[model samples]
Target: MNYTLHQLHVFFKISQTQSITRAAEELHLTQPAVSIQLKNFQDQFEIPLTEVISRRIYLTDFGWEIARAAEKILTETHAINNRILAHKGLLYGRLTVSVVSTGKYVMPYFLSGFMRQHEGLELVMDVTNRQKVIASLAKNEVDFALVSILPQQLNVQQLDLMPNKLYLVGRRLDDSSLLSDDPGQLEKLPLIYRENGSGTRSIMETFITDHQLVVRKRLELTSNEAVKQALLAGLGYSVMPLIGIKNELLTNELQIIPIKGLPLQTSWMLIWHKDKQFSPVAQAYLSYLRANKEMIVQASFDWYQQF
Candidate 1:
């Protein structure tokens, strides 16, 4: 009954990670420290909160219920802190955003200025696949979701930020004439791919199907990083976001293969459920984005537009 807020915080992290060691690493605490706090918290309750089976932690039904309550309590705590700050004409609160894996390259540009303006705010950016981003938005688990391909399944409002261009790229070829102009030539090179549910993968598949290109699917990777590595190793070519390969392109590590009607286009968007009630922090973020999105795009990605 005498559980401290700190105990709840520790337990919440443990529940999310499902590993005391990982929780400790993220919290910047020692393993023993996290274990001690968890034990202390569990001592206050008669029912077991976490049970270890085969050295793996599992939250019991009671533990799941407590975890849900802890999340609400933590949210309210953030609200209270922001409320106090607002009284003094200052901004303070937590902002959580979920973005597709490739959006890691883009969301920071949108967030940098807002973060500088509100130094007191706590922000969590979760980079995941498109499916998870959609799920988070549908479940109202996050304040915003950043994606290239719009999720039609969710009734959401969105702010279009910038154009996302996907280009067919491979390792720089020493001989320009080695690659042919024939449309059927691409079929000879293996095609690297992102996973099935990825926005980029969807776009790539659509392009291939529309063109009736018979490609050798060499590898299927779950992330952009892996696909890029595969490209660098001369394993295969992939249609990747130009933003991600800017440095590689500039350094001549990767070269775009100009296919007819190439560089598939989509706009990057910041989306939220239509009925989402924004927290004060979320409101501040949206306001900043609306006011400065154009400026941020121009400043941070001027080269992108030029290219």
Candidate 2:
């Protein structure tokens, strides 16, 4: 009735491993400490929970019963936590999130609005590539992710927020001296592309293959800035997300290449694991995303539709 959660977790770990030393290693505690806790539990219950023969620990009948009961208790405790956190206007918890670098422009504005609504929440954001985002989501390292596409293996619950269109960008639209204005002229111009495992890169590849377009490989870069610099410097033209080049488009630092079927259409999805339970902060943030969905779509997403 009065056992600590740590003690219950340790009990489960020890029972599963069937080795106190292994359990201690898993829990980052000393062997003697684990042994003492087990002994304390046995004394408190007035029953022998463990029997050691030939230096191997085996759970006795009572030990098995307590371990099973501990699992149920832990499960109920987690359910209670979820229910309590679900109450309105009670958003206080840690929310770890990951997003592609291209989404930085759109995600921050939406997240800022959510933070204002839930002032008590703590936020941790990781700007990583698409592969890392998927890996982190499946490992439960991040509570949620805003990504172009979720991995197939993950049991992801996705909300399609808005579509992102890919654009062929260059230094200026007037500088048609480099590549032809015709759509099939993509084969002649040098192409700047993102590194492998990038969501934008994957989308680009699919679009190119589908449209039967070929490009002369000019340069490869990691960041969008690098890609922009390369285009501005007239090294090569590149396909990039419209969101990433809003400022460049406004300042006339970069221009979209005039070609039919140039901007391939793809949507950004707000995704999280289907099996995992969301905390108060994460749920609140999701609600905020859905509520202001139009504003987010209009902010940085309108550029693609304009073309």
Candidate 3:
């Protein structure tokens, strides 16, 4: 069966996004236009390709098989284009990176600079939580991930980007003000924990368990921003990344409660699949990260400390 590259691109995109509307948004096509293209591809085949239930789209078994083939074809096409661009002495390609939300504060700045430096490259940045970032990397859905927490799977190359320290923060006048710099004080403060499965939550759990301290409060939240807001509102004390609340610290909306014996170290990492081949643009982006690693870490420390 003969199908145009555009139809294959639509098929791949829809399969990747799992929703025609999202695929349309990504490809800058109207919903009807995307549906029509998908219909054309389905018409070329012997079996049904797509179905909708509860307004959600799903590919049939045959459709998935075709989508996988289309993926291989697209990958080869990209490789050929990269080879031609290399021959022309031009570095041109696409790189999609997934990152944890906390890293969103500084990671995008570096990525923006890299894109500016490599003018011909196209970049897509997906900022989500740490767990989502890991899933993206594991699925080979993104070129790389910037994460503060290590993944459960150990197959990816995780280069240390910077040290992320956890701080116990609270409203300036909250009951947690009674918390002294002593680590034992952690047992007395009402604790606001990150949502389960978070890298930060994992670290906190390990620290508390190792110390044999019973957590005084167990309110759980997901985002760093949510944790900070809860603390600022005097709901309870929270262990949060220093970068997440720099502005709050600067404004004195919240203050760090010095807690001793807490594990203060988790490194932000640039993670990618060990077996995945890097295009020239991807290599240059990684090189840019390593080249500025120390400077970036130091500046982040300085900026957070100013609060």
What are the runs in model 1 whose C-alpha is more than 4 Å off? 1-8, 25-53, 57-80, 174-178
**Highest TM-score scorer:** 1
Better of 2 and 3 by lDDT: 3
Clashing pairs in 2: none
lDDT, candidate 3, 37-81, per-residue tens:
998888897789888889789999988998999999988987887
134-206 in candidate 1: lDDT tens per residue? 9999998999999998888989999999999998899865666647755565687789999999999999999
- Sort by TM-score, best first: 1, 3, 2
Least accurate 10 contiguous residues by lDDT in model 3: 298-307
CA lDDT of each prediction against the hidden true structure: 0.90, 0.80, 0.81
Candidate order by lDDT, decreasing, is 1, 3, 2
- Report clash pairs, candidate 3: none
Distance from true location, Cα of 139 in model 3, Å = 2.0
lDDT of 2 at 154: 85
Q: Please say which candidate is ahead in lDDT: 1 or 3.
A: 1
